[model samples]
Target: MKNALKEIILAAATAAHQKGIFPSSDFCEVVLEEPKADSHGDLSTNMAMQMAKTQRMSPRKIAETLIDHLDDTRGLIDRTEIAGPGFINFFIRPSAWYPVLAAIHEQDDQYGRCDLGKGTRIQIEFVSSNPTGPLHVGHGRGGAVGDSTANILSFCGFDVQKEYYINDSGRQIQTLGMSVYLRGKELLGETVDFPDTCYQGDYIRDLAGELLEREGRELFDKSEAETIMPCARYAAEKITEGMRADLVDFGVTFDQWFSEQSLYDSGKVAGDIRDFKEKGLIYEKDGALWFKTSDYGDEKDRVVVRQNGQTTYFASDITYHKDKFERGFQKVIDVWGADHHGYIPRMKAAVVASGYDRDQFNVLLVQLVNLLRAGQPVAMSTRAGEFVTLSDVVKEVGRDAARFIFLTRHYESSLDFDLELAKQKTNDNPVYYVQYVHARISSIHRKAGSDGLDVSGFAPSDLSALETREDIVLIKALARYPEAVETAGALREPHRITYYLMTLSAAFHTYYNRHRVLCEDDLKLTRARLYLISAVQKVIRNGLALLGVSAPDAM
Candidate 1:
């Protein structure tokens, strides 16, 4: 519908230009948007206001001129009016929305998809948690945001590749190995002092036990120094396996599980440093190789390699991004935790210094998630190994509720995930509320079938019987689905879909309360309402699918 309105505005502008109302046909892009109130109009545009300076006319006069030249021969619009400050308001005929229902039926699951991306090769790397520990609630929020964003962009015609960068080669992995090895020593009746900085999760003990069962007491025969690397390797593998299972249970599957170690092994990190040196972006300062990131907007220069010759994490990340661009990805989006917000400037500087356009790289910062139960904060400490894992949240609340609640707010804002509210079956729980709308429509369809109504044969003509105010409002709400999806996808924000679903669901619930769908005296109206609700069901299902939530026929 937004596209249709844009086309109408373009046609009106062209006609006015052809009639010499304006000096030339060249004009800025037409921007149409929904009005705040239904009384204003179905859609509003500021095209005339934008063109007023170019035409040397008042905005009001330009708006009137454009409206005069508008072609509504097909009755697509009921009327056009000029409002305050020369804004053109277009009121679409109620019957013009009937094709939206037909489109819903024809497209089914593919109704809200748009070609806004034009098949751009985009890679989104998110939830790239280190393999040293299990993912916590914060990581879970990242997963939901990343996965939903990927799904939305894919539906919008972008070739999106979801990736998880494993921080497997770091001090954390060595700490994980030490933790497991010390636990194994304890299992072997040896008194070993565990460091306070080592991983203390129960999963470490489980890994040690598994290692004992597989490698046996022979591992104990070797010195602790000799066993450290093996222990770390086994622990990382086991932890990564558990992480994979947890993400799968949460309905997130990545197209690639990129290993950070591979970058160093492939000499990409060194190659990146050499490239920066050749470009004069790298300089040696105080026995360390530094990148002049401050020249590209960073607050200060950053050390890429230490005096001891070991590269910092920043070096690996720069090469990783370079490798992404080299892999034919036109756009790269990195989903990082809010704590990494300060790291964005340096990373963007590296991308720009590496000869890529600044716009080609984007970083989405996902704020922390605070888990609550009945209004009290749930205690969690990642370092103490006492944090609530992602699997725990999924177990407490179903995946559908978890994913929906995770996306209820934008990723930039901190989320307070209430386990109790998420589990509720009432309207307070948005996932349940939206699912119930779908279920209610399914029930109506079944009831109509039981009454010997052939709802499947209902044609566009039957929709003429939908003349009530609530009927028109419901159709209008349904019409916003595609626009909502396109906007959300283009803006790289998945929360918009959740907002749209909640609005549509509320509208449907209100209409159901005030109206009767199965009118025995007015069979035509009943069939029309049935078709309307069916379209609503289809849209709800489609939106929920994009969020990776289940839309059940029955709650």
Candidate 2:
């Protein structure tokens, strides 16, 4: 549909060129928009207004000329109107949209797919939660956003890589080890005080039990420095295992689990710092190695290495990004929590300093998620090991319900995920609303098959014969699916798919309530209606699949 729209605009431009008028190619970016109110038309574009300055004419005149020159595709486009301020609104015929049902039937699950990306290599790094504790609701939000985003990109024809950057070389892992060790000691009847910095989740006890089973009492009684590192290593591994299980249950997988420790082991961090020093981009100030990030529009010069000779998180990030680019990814998308919002500029500056185009990198700051139970906020305390873990949420609500609820809101907005609301089987839970449509469609197909009708190799012609208004609405919504997918994928906003699925399912349910697809007398119409409804069902299924949500044929 995007390509179709582009062809229409380009044809109009070519006509203006033939008329010895400066043909407007710049209208390419002129917002080709869908009318907010359905009464306006099927589709609208502001190409004329965008060309007004170049054409040396008012937008209305330019629209009139362009509309006159638009090529006719049979009767697909009934007419093109130049509305207020040169808005070109195209009124496409019913037959034009009717083909979309056939197209869906023909293409099946691959209807909305495109080759726009052309297999460009891309890497999306997201949800690299620390191994110190189990993933919370905040981490769940990141998981859904990152997984769905990568899924959307993959559907759009990119050779996409999903990555998780493990912060295994950090202080947090050590704190986790100490927490587990202390819990183990307490279990052994030793009065051990838990450190304030240690992870205080009940999962720590589980990790401790594993350590006890592995190393026994000898390692437990070892000296603090010797015991802490190995214990931390064990704890980190255990916690990361839990993270993996949780994500697997949530339906996300990573192509790579990049270790921060590798950067240090391979001397990439030192090499990057040395390279920056050679380029005069680094300087020693008050015993710290400072990178000239301020020169690249950052707020201030940032320390890559502190006065104590230890590299900061920023240094590790610099080498990691450098490694990402060197891996030959044409584009890199990093999904960071919103609290790390300030880190965006410095990372981009480092990429620029490393001599890479800034456009190649994108940082998406997922705002946050505040979990609620019934209608009140759920209090969480990591120290007491009493927080609502992501796994807990999954157990409370099934994976499909959990994922659909998490994705119901945009990633950039704070989410108020309510346990009770998400668990509902009604329309309040959009997962069910969308799935019900799929199941209903499936039921219709089953009925069609049982009635001895040959559904295979069936072709739908004369869609006008199916005259229910609900049928038209369903066809219209299905027709808009390709455009919806294009918009959602282009904008990297998966929430649009959620919204679209809801609207599509609503149309199906409304039609189901008002109209009947199965009848003994109107067998041909029933079959045609089933064909139409089943196509819509496939679209809904595909859309849910893109969001990593399930569309069950039953319940």
Candidate 3:
């Protein structure tokens, strides 16, 4: 319907231009959008205002000329009004909205989908936490946002690959190994001093105990240097396994688990530096190799290799991103913590330096999650290993509630997840409220079935029975589902879908309370209402599914 309106206006403008009503006949763009207030109209456009300078006339006069040329002879638009300073508002016929219901019924699960992306290959890397310990609440929030954004893009016709980059070759992994090794020696009653830089998590002790059970007293006899590598490898494997399990419980499964160490093992890091040097983007300074990132808008030049001859993490990141592009991804999106905001400029500079378009690379900065219980902040310390784990949150709140709450806010904004509120079954919980709408509609269908009415098979021809204001408003909300999805996907914001579902649920709840769905005296109205609510049920299910939330028939 939006496309149809834009075409109508564009054709009118072209015809008017050809008839010498305007100076230029080449009007290539037309925007048709919905007005905020219902009284304004169904759709509004400012084509006349845009053409005022080109047509050499007042905006209102041009608007009048375009309106005179508009062909609504097909009964698509009921009326057109000139509002404000030359704004053309289109009021679509109420009967024109009935096709939306038919679309919902026919498309079923695929109703709100659009082919806006046209199958662009995209890679989204998210929640690439170091495998030093269990994932915390912050990682959980990133998981929800990244997973849902990938789902939305895929629904919008993009070929999306979800990936988790493992930081297994960094200093953190070495620290984890030393932590487990010291703990293993301590388990053998050795008087070894543990350093402050070692990981303090109790899981390190658990890994030590497991190693003792497997290798017995031989582990105690090995030198510290020999023990470090084995312990690090074992701890990294175990912790990474736990991370995978937790994500699975949260309903997030990645298409690939990329290793950071692969860049070094495959010589990609050195090869990248050589390529940059060949392009004169690299220079030697004080016995260290520096990349001229400042030329590409970085705060200053960055060292790719230190004076000690070890490559920096930034060097490895550049290589990894280059590998992503070389693998044929047209676009790459990285979801990182808000603290990494300073890293975006350097990364984007690296993309440009590597001969890739800067616009093809994007970083989504996800803010922190502050978990609370009854309005009180929960204390967490990752260094001390006393923080709440993602698995713990999922076990307490359930995956559906946890994910829904995590996605209730925009990724750029901090979220305060209330533990008690999420556990409640009341209307105050948005997930419960939205799920209840689906369940409520399902119950209505069951009631109609028991009353010997074929509600599923009934297709009323005279939808004019749904001419009431509440019925029309509900229909309008239902019709906005596709627009909501398209906007959310285009903006890469999943919170928009949540807001839409909440508004639609509220509208349905109000209408259900005020009106009767199974009217015995008026079977025509009953069938019509049932059909409308059924469409509502399908839309709610589709929206929730995109957010990775469940829509139960009985809640």
Candidate 4:
């Protein structure tokens, strides 16, 4: 409907231009917005106001001139009015809204899908937690944000590939290995001093026990230094496998699991650095190779390789990002923890230094989740050797609630994920509230079917009976879904979908209470209402899918 209004405004301006009522046929894009007050009409646009200064006319005069030339041959507009300061308010005919139901039924799942991206190749890498520790609540939040953002962008017609970058290299892995090795020594009755630098998680001990069970006593013949890499490899691989399983359970599956070590193993890190050196992007300083990221956008030059001939993590990162663009991706996105906020400039600088536009790379930082029980912060159980792992939360509250709540706010905003609130079945729970809309619509259909009315699909009918205020409100709400999706995709925020779902659900609930759908005296009215709700059902399902949440037919 907004699009329709834009067309009408264009036609009016063009016709006025031809008649010399307006100066030029060329005009700025029409910007329409829902009026805050009910009296302002269904939608209002400031196109006239925007044009007044440029056309050397009063905004009111411009608005009046455009109104005179309104081309509503399709009967889309009931009437138009010039509001204060020359805002053109368009009150659409109630009959104009009837086609939305048919379009919804015709498109069904594809109703909200768009072509805003036009098939641009995009890669989104997220939840790349180090393979040393199990995934915490923060990683879970990052996963949900990434997966849902990918879904939204895909729905908006971007060619999206989800990726998980495994940080299985460098110091962290060695520490994990030492943690496991020291624990293994304890298991073998060796009086080994465990360093404070090693991991303290019980999972490390579990890994050590598993290693002993698999490799046995003979494997311990090697010195501690000799076995560190094997221990590191074992711990990393196992933890990564566990992370993969947990993420799958949380409704996140990446198209790629990129290994940081792969860049090193393929000699890409060395090769890429040499290329940068040749290009003078990298230089030898004090027996260390440094990337001149400061020249691009970074705050200062960063070392890629130290004097010890060991490459820093940034070296592998530079190679990895260059590999991303080389894979034919037009854009690359990463979801990272908020603690990594300062890392953005250097990473963007790396992209610029590596021959890609810095704008081609973007990062979505997910703030830490404040896990609470009821209204109180939940404490990790040290006695039980339990941390607030993502798997633990999912096990306690279920995936739908977890994912939905994780997306209830912008990723950059701190989210208070109340486990107790998530598990509640009442309307206070946003997930349940939105999901009940789907279930209630299904119940409506079930009642219709039980009454011997065919609930399969909607056909063209006299939807004139749907001229009530509640019906119009629902139609408007349904219409906003696609727009919400587009905005969310453009901004890379999936939380907007959650807001839309809640609003749509609230609209449907209001309509449901105010009107009845299966009236015997007015079969036409009943059919119209049923068709409208089926569209609501479809949209709710589609929205829930974007958040990786299920729309259960019955609650």
Candidate 5:
């Protein structure tokens, strides 16, 4: 209907221009927006004002001329008005919205899916935590955002691959090895001083104990350097496996688990640096190789290789991202902790320095999660291994509640996850509030079916029975599901679907309370309402699926 309205107005403008009544047949962009207030109209556009300068006339006059030429052959627009500043407000016929319900029923799961990405290859790398310890709440939040983002993008017709880049190499792993090694020596009755640089976690001791039992005393008899790598590999492999298991339990499974060591091992890092040097993007200063990041919008130059000849962590990141583009992804999105917010510019610089478009690189900086019981904050520390793991949260609250809660807010904002509220079956709990609508609608269908009404087989002729105010509002909300998904995907904000679900759920609950779907008095109206709510059910299910949450038949 929005597209129809745009066509009608554009046709009118073209007619006006052909008759030489309006100058410049080429006009500015015609954007139709829904007015905030219902009285303003169903949709609004400012094409006349946009064309005022081109037509060399008053916006009001041009609006009037264009309005006069509108054909309305499709009979979609009820009326049109020239409002303040020459805004053309379109009042669409109420009957036009009824078709939305039919469309929803016909499309089903494919209703909200769109082609905004148009099959563009996109890679989303998220929650790439160091394989040194269990995943903390922050990683959980990132996992949710990244997984949902990939889901939404895939729904929007992007060739999406979800990946988790494993930081299995470098200094962190060495420290983890040392931490486990020192703990292993202590387990062997050797008096060794543990350095403060070592990881302080009970899991480290557990890894040491496991290594002692598995490899025995002979392995420990080797030189400390020899034992360090084995311990590091063992602990890293164990921790990474735990992370993968936890993420799967949390309702996120990646398409790939990329190893950071692969870049160095495959010589991609050195080959990439050589290419950069050939392109003159790499330079030397004080015996260190620096990338010309400042020239590509970074705050200053960044060292890819230190004076000691060891590549920095940033070097591997640059290679990884560049490798992402080389692997045929037109766009790369990285989900990182908000603490890495400052690193975005330099990363963007690296992307551009590597000959990729700046717009092709995007980052979602997810803020910390503040877990609470009731209203009080729960204490947590990642280094001390005292923080609540994602697995623990999922076990307590269930995966659906956790994913929905993690996605309740935009990724840039901090989330306050209340264990008590999530467990409650009340309307105050947002996930339950939304899920109940689906369950309630399912109950309605069951009731209608048992009551001898063919609710599932509802075939509509004229939906004039759905002419009530609440009916129109609900139908309009249903009509906007695709818009919500498109906006969420285009803007990279997964919370839009969450907000849409909440609103739709509220509207459905209000309507359900005020009216009866399986009314015995008016059979026609009952079937109409049944079909409408069925569309609602389908949409709710689709939205929850995008967020990786379940829309249960019984909550």
Candidate 6:
């Protein structure tokens, strides 16, 4: 529908130019909208207001000129009125919306699919939690947002690769190993003082038990120097296994699990630092090696390697971005928590320092989610291992509800995840609302064949008979899906889809409450209405699928 409006607006522009209203054809991108009240108009555009200053005429005159040229609309437009401040409000005919039902039926699940992306290669890296502990609810939000965003962009024809950056070469992995080893030593009746650096989760105890069952207690009793690295490796594997299972159960699968350790093992980090050094981007000061990130946009120079001979996390990050660009992605998007907002500038500086276009790198900051149980906040302390894991939420509310609730808001906004609200099966829960629409449509279809309706000879009657205001309302809502999908894909926002689903479901429920389809008043009209509802069912299913939420026919 947005594309259709653009076409109409451009034609209006041509008509205005022919009347000597403008010298050039370039005009502002006019906004096409639907008024809040049903009495206003079906669709409205502010083209006249945008052209007023350029054409040096009153907006009313420009609106009249454009409406005069709108003569060739062939009754698709019922009437045109000049609204406030010279806005052209188009009251479209029922025919204009009726064809949308046919289009939806013909297209089925492919209704809103588009090619705006033109197959541009883009990579989105997110939920790259360290393989040191189980993934908590914080990681759940990131997973939902990232996965749904990728699904939307892909549906719009972008070549997108969802990736997870595994931080395996870090101190956290060592801490996980120490945690497991200390727990195992305790099990072996050995006196041990567990450090604050060790992991405190009960999952660490399970991993230690498994390791002891296989390798015995002698492994932990070995020299600390010989034991720590192996313990870290084992703990990393155990944690990563759990994370992979959790993500998979949550309906997310990354195309790539990139490793930070691989960057060091492959010598890519050393090579990148050496190249930056040769480019005079690196220097030594105060016995520390630093990158001149300030030259790009950072507030100060960042130390790549300390005098203690250990490279900082930022040093390895430079190599990671370099690796992503090396893989031929035109753009790299990193989804990080809002706490890491200050890190974006330096990451962009590293990309520029590595001789890549700074604009090609983008950091999307996902604001934190505050988990609430009942009406109170759920306090969590990671050090104490009292955090709610993503799996815990999934197990409690089910995966579909979890994904839907997590994606119900914009990623940049702080999300208040209320456990009480999420568990509800009523109208307050948006997921159930959409699923109920699907189930209702399915029930209508089931009754059609049993009502002695001929299945083979049946064809959807002309939608011109769909004249009720509620019927047209549902048709218009279905027609606006492509526009919603395109806007969401272009903006990289999944919440738009959630908003659309809620509106679409509202229209469906409204129509369902007022009309009876299985009655004998008009069987042909009954089939037509059922066909329209069937199309709605398909759309709801497809939209929910994109968000990784299920649409059950029976539920």
* Candidate with best TM-score: 4
- Alpha-carbon deviation at 15 in model 1, angstroms: 3.9
RMSD of each: 1.9, 2.6, 1.7, 1.7, 1.7, 1.7
Error of 5 at 106 (Å): 1.3
Off by over 4 Å in 3: none
Clashing pairs in 5: none
lDDT of the structure predicted as candidate 2: 0.83
Lowest summed lDDT across 10 adjacent residues in model 4 is found at 453-462
Q: Write the number of the candidate with greater TM-score, choosing between 1 and 4.
A: 4
Clashes in model 6: which pairs?
none
Error of 6 at 184 (Å): 2.1
Judging by lDDT, tell me the better candidate of 5 and 6.
Answer: 5
Candidate 5 global TM-score: 0.96
Residue 68 local lDDT, model 5: 95
Model 1 ranges off by over 4 Å: 17-28
TM-score (all chains, Cα) for each model:
0.95, 0.92, 0.96, 0.97, 0.96, 0.96
- What is the per-residue lDDT of model 3 for residues 295-323, given as tens digits with 9 covering 90 to 100? 98899999999999988999999999999
Structural RMSD, model 2: 2.6
Number of residue pairs clashing in candidate 6, backbone atoms closer than 3 angstroms, sequence gap of 3 or more or interchain? 0
Model-by-model lDDT, in order? Answer: 0.90, 0.83, 0.91, 0.91, 0.91, 0.86
lDDT of 4 by residue, 1-555 (tens): 988888989988988888887876668899999999878899999998889766788999999999999889899999889888999999999989888888888898898899999999999999999999888888899999999999999999999999999999998999988888888888899888987678888898899899899999665558988988899999999999999999999999999999999998999998999898999899998999999989987889999999999889888999999999999999999999999999899999999988899899999999988889989998765334467999999999999999999999999999999999999999999999999999999998888888887534544665787988899999999989889999999999999999999999999999989899988776777888887888999999999999999999999
User: Cα deviation in Å at residue 87, candidate 4?
Assistant: 1.1
lDDT (Cα, tens digit) per residue for candidate 5, span 393-510 = 9999999999999999998989999999999999999999999999998998787777787544455663788888788889988988998999999999999999999999999988
lDDT: which is higher, 3 or 6?
Answer: 3
